[model samples]
Target chain A: MSAERQGAASAAPDPRISMRGIVKRFGSVEALRGVDLDLHAGECLGLVGDNAAGKSTLTKILSGAYVPDGGEIRVNGRRVDFRNPADARVHRIEMVYQDLSLCDTIDVAGNLFLGREPMRGAFLDRRAMRDGARAMLDRLEIKIPRLDALVAQLSGGQRQAIAICRAAAFDPEVLIMDEPTSALAVAEVEAVLALINRVKASGVSVVLITHRLQDLFRVCDRIAVMYEGVKVAERRTAETDLQDLVSLIVGEKHVSKAAGAAAGPGGAA
Target chain B: MTAYTSRPAGSRLADMLATHAQLLSIAGFFLIMVVIFSVMSPVFLTTGNLLNVLRQAAPILIVAVAMTFVITTGGIDLSVGSTVALINALAAILIQFGIPWQAVVPALLLIGSAVGAAQGWFIAYQGIQPFIVTLAGLSALRGIALLMTEGFSVPIPGGIGFVQIGRGWFAGVPAPAWIAVVAAVAGFLALTGMRFGRYVTAIGANQEAARRAGIPTRRILLSVYVLTGLASAVAGIVIAARLGSGSSNAAVGLELDVIAAVVLGGTSLMGGRGSILGTILGALTIAVIGNGLILAHVSPFFTQIVAGAIILLAVWLNARVFSRLAAGTRRRT
Candidate 1:
């Protein structure tokens, strides 16, 4: 909450990432069509939409999982093209995939340091890795009793947390998470929202995609609603309640006036 | 807020046990086999007989170590036996032509790598299923071997230093056994303490995820097959050196034994999990059974039956007993 207040007080903070007219196609289906978004430093942007609304696709493009057929991406006012995930990573952009992207049979420490393991000459520095993992988990306030436990043994929320921590630990200027809390329990969801606040406080821009509309109010400074590959509305969290977002996500014409009004009070909290 | 207390201290011990449940079960089975064989046959525990068993089991052990890496990556090299046969025949042909054994040794290894790289190209870069590709290699490679040797055994002349590689002893252990030991130790170190092993495990667990994590997954996949090919070449050379002759018919059906040994060692055929120590025990167990049956005056054919039954039972124990134990402990906590 303090981070959001500070972000608002700043005078027109420069966007850490800017995407203009981003377009992507998947053989005949246009997954993303002419979408524009700007993510400022120290802000969380909540992306919400119904199924097939292009939320995942857009974020994937941003994270370099998909190549945009048309449009430009700017990081810190410099135009850049990401040919692959590695390219985005060079610019300190990280993403927690919807699938989690964790090797189930690998230990928690191993998963966190998957491709870029700490090595001593030709061998993996396992002791250093375990120690680094312990420190990383502690810094995130994530509690898992054993670092060597295989990811398959961990619960869904713990796995999600590990994935998020993996991305966040990279000291990314921008972090994108797709449906991070969709499968989490109530306490886990709260923990994730709190983690987002912490990240924002450190001046990292976060793009969060979720179906849970109410979660945006908890951590997001701004919300962007998408419908069928197009961004329909962008609202400041303090200015617009969840009712506006719900209508915006559903596309205004689809919702009756009664439902919009009915949703108002519940959406405010 | 639930403070997320660490599971009780006892569970730490339980966790360690559960993680190694497959290995421990296999080890127990290996010990039981050793005991049963020792009791049934008086000569089974003799040092000379044991040395012979070690010498004979060396080739299979070496290749099984490589296959552990392959299987851990969710791939199989069915062509390994055929590769061994090809190298076996090729080495004899070269030695018959008066090529020095030292030169031929490295040459055969390179040939093995080339063959593996070719197959790996198809499986890795060409997007073919490893099973289908290696199955094709099994037939083609054996065919090549038969054609080269003309269905005849080629004799390696005596008094050559090449024989020492297979028959000589080092510190009272057979050369081949020493070689197998070296390969196993190297494999253990690489798989347990290296990044390559981690990537292989990751690739097996989830290929796309590994790729997204910036790992060159296809290269790693291709390299594992190369290891198998190289190991097969070593095995082929040892077989030729020991017998002082090479034939295309050598090592026929050997792939099955190697696969069985690896699986019996608790490495999952589905991939993402493996153990070199288990593979070592598994290979020795199979070797012991074959040797023990001959010493016990049992029918040679029954050895196969016993070995097959034991493999099936060990795998069942791993999948059923160990998993259930792990699950039961989880439920209690």
Candidate 2:
């Protein structure tokens, strides 16, 4: 991103993506109510909350997996309506689902280019898929045994890498990753964190949803905390610590802490 | 760093074997069946008997090839036999009405595809179980055929060149076998190389994932059934032409044989894995068992019993012994 885009001191720049009054309901349960968010280019915004705090719902609406019951999403200053994930993809929005959304029977290269495979006349462009998969893995700094390996035989982290590689390879402008590191081992988490940073450096706006509070400080430029179905607080990562974030997430006396600097005990960043 | 650090990678050969353990086991078993049958019956090794076997296996091979696509998507079409009977009777009735053979063939194929499409819509779009939908098809379709033909065999006039489809030869190979070979090759190309085949496998593997990836999964699922229907029509035409008559009772247990052939070839009933080559071997294996048994003087009724036993044995070995063998070989290497 340009230098002006990174400065948040004054003269706020236009957000890469903006959402206003997002609301979603599953019958009697209100999943999200009147939630608004702004994401800038080349930044990772951490979304943290309890289970059903509307984090995943908000992200799902953003990724076009679910249409908000009422909301306006503006991307690059233009309002767009998405009816499905395919529509979101047209505007370069992508999400790595928590389930990983991968075909275990297909090879790595095939999974990377599932619906949009490169075809040569009547057949798949196998050579292109192989070389393209190699290039994407190289760019993301992810390694696996072979491009032709079936996903079922790969380790969990490798499978996660494949899922991440698929979303990142598509040059998405707004990438949402829901708990990418939830099931990974420790070393694998480090690798995924490194990969997230790599993706962010390429000037893509990223939304990361995770319960690992410690991970927020390491990768997020700003943290957004949710309580119930409402976004209760937003904090610049430099100005907040784990205690404050925890308090914000749990909605515990948020008003008193609101006035303080919230520079409590340092977190495990 | 590599994404996974748990273990060293195995040799490519070992990996390949493990990946294709089912195919390898079925292939080896097929070869073993051929050898045993040849030894058991002196006539089995001859060119004439093998061609006769090919002719007998042609209908099963053609339908089994299509069933491989259906099974690969984790769906079963139990109505294939009924489909054939319906198409067979309908063609005879249409021919008896003095229609051209050329027009009737294409017309029957379209009807077959329509029948399959109807079933597919319920299973794919309506979200019904394939087993239930096709089981209903099995009963309803044959009932229609029986009502149309009134439980009687309808005969076609001789020497209209239609019977050539079932009995005629080109380059000394049986015409039905040639048509089967064509179907197999086309199905093979579509399943292994084309985007259609990839999407079919993907749908079977993880349907939600495939859908989220933007694959037209329901359309693909629907199309596989259409393939089975079209293949059944071809089988029906071949049968009607060969016998000079159409019977509702024709191919009574054919669904069992086709399903047996597909499953025996190692296509999973649970979906996501398929092999056209395997289905060909599997159908041929079943045909040889039937032909070889009769030549060995076993009662005709025993063929069903023996074929059932073999299917059970082959699948058991593929899942248990051969899979372990594949893993063990990998570890040893």
Candidate 3:
């Protein structure tokens, strides 16, 4: 997964969530090999890697979007297992994928709850849902005129905000976002970065997976890099340079020794 | 900004016009025909003729209601026509074997639902293309109907229970017309008020998203198909009652008419955007067009050609109106 997920490995730094020895395979391709990860309270962990570097696979496992082949997961130092996204939701874990997973034809309220729509009698309680959706949007400072306006009518940034609002409305303890701003315009990307900061300030731990190094340096408190299926290095934003991170991600053996030696002190990446 | 963001006055008028465009256009067409027919013939606008039109529209409306569901799911059941034929054949065979009409009603309904479920399972679970499965069904079910009836019509016996279902009436309205009203109301309720309706729309909008959202996509798909079958069976019974007989050839080529009504009513063939109100309007439009054509003394062959052309035109217009509505705004960055 992302290097930011790896931290103070052997010392056990009071992690809110941790995964140990996670192994996953898709046919003959080993996507993850004995991976370890941890997330602390209210910390934004920025995970970076090249294409097919297992960043997505790890996020999927943590969010209960996929089942890991072998691993034990711990929440607040207590062991737990998740069989589905709903199961993870019980533990206050939610994921907002890059696609946003919002139904384009439905309005914000409908997309917010989706399959979990609130109903009164035989019909959907549109007023109640709309009110709740509006409240969530207001808190996020994203204004759309009508709760009934379809997502297809919204801008890319606005849709991303709605998605984060949805995950936040559910009151998840940990929120994972996959490449939240990869396809956005410059302004839209800035809006999403601001939303991420707002989400972190609200005391919800955020795991951001992205390939954009600039975004990592901009918003991430801790940076993690993954090479192939293994996390190569993890460093605090203050301690690591972009070139060293790039060297680890590209699997250059010349700098691997120095990078590995520094990361090993804290058993990170 | 509000004024600019809002629909134009002309577009607002257009929106209202477009909302009931199918009905308005169909009525306009009917009025022109009525004016011509009244000029040419004395008995063109008689009550008897109007009632006759109602009777003709009954079976088509029933079949079209089922088509509404199929089309709403971004799928079509080419087998509905065949299912109607099969139902008719089965009803006749059972009646001939001394089975009570009450029992036969349930049997036909069950058979219809089962056939629909089979098609739906293939579409939803097996990932088979709807066109192929229903097209295969169109052939298979008709063959079954032919096999059972041996390609012959079966005469209705006297004093059959629920024969009144086809021929009976409440107050002054025909029983079939009342049944059509009830079916339409039920369909409207199911589409707008129930959980099933929501799931159907979700599946139509994006099956993958709906599935990931934990919708019972497979089950709902099965139900939609089975519902269509049930509708077909109901139409079959009404047809059999109206004719006082059943034949393997009953409801032949009816699928095209039902689909035409659905598309004309503004139900997107692409799914995720259909309404019972629209379907009702669409079905009425088709009935009016067909009735008006005959009243105007048009040749039956020309009527068929004109009807097909009108359906295509209505759908094309519906697409333009909707796309305009969907593309109403541009961001002001």
After TM-score superposition, the amount by which residue B311's alpha carbon in candidate 2 deviates from its true location, in angstroms, is 1.2
lDDT of 3 by residue, B29-73 (tens): 445545765676666578766666667777778778777877777
In model 2, pairs of residues that clash are: none
lDDT of 3 at A47: 84
* Model 1 root mean square deviation, Cα atoms: 3.5
- Tell me the TM-score of each prediction against the true structure: 0.93, 0.93, 0.85
**Candidate 2 segments exceeding 4 Å error:** A1-13, A253-269, B1-6, B329-333
**Each model's DockQ score:** 0.47, 0.47, 0.27
- CAPRI-wise, candidate 1 is acceptable
Real interface contacts reproduced by model 2, as a fraction: 0.58
Better of 2 and 3 by lDDT: 2
The docking category that best describes candidate 3 is: acceptable
B1-333, model 1: which lDDT tens digit per residue? 632223333477677777777788888888888899899988999999999999999999999999999999999999999999999999999999999999999999999988989999999999999999999999999999999999999999989999999889999999999999999999999999898989999998998888878888889999999999999999999999999999999999889989989988888788898899999998998898888888988888787887778778878886788657755554211
* Residues A131-171 of candidate 3: C-alpha lDDT, one tens digit per residue: 88888777766666667666665667677777777877777
lDDT of 2 by residue, B256-296 (tens): 99998898888888889899988998899899888888988
RMSD of each: 3.5, 3.8, 5.6
Worst 10 residues of 1 chain A by lDDT: A1-10
How large a fraction of the reference contact set does each model reproduce? 0.52, 0.58, 0.23
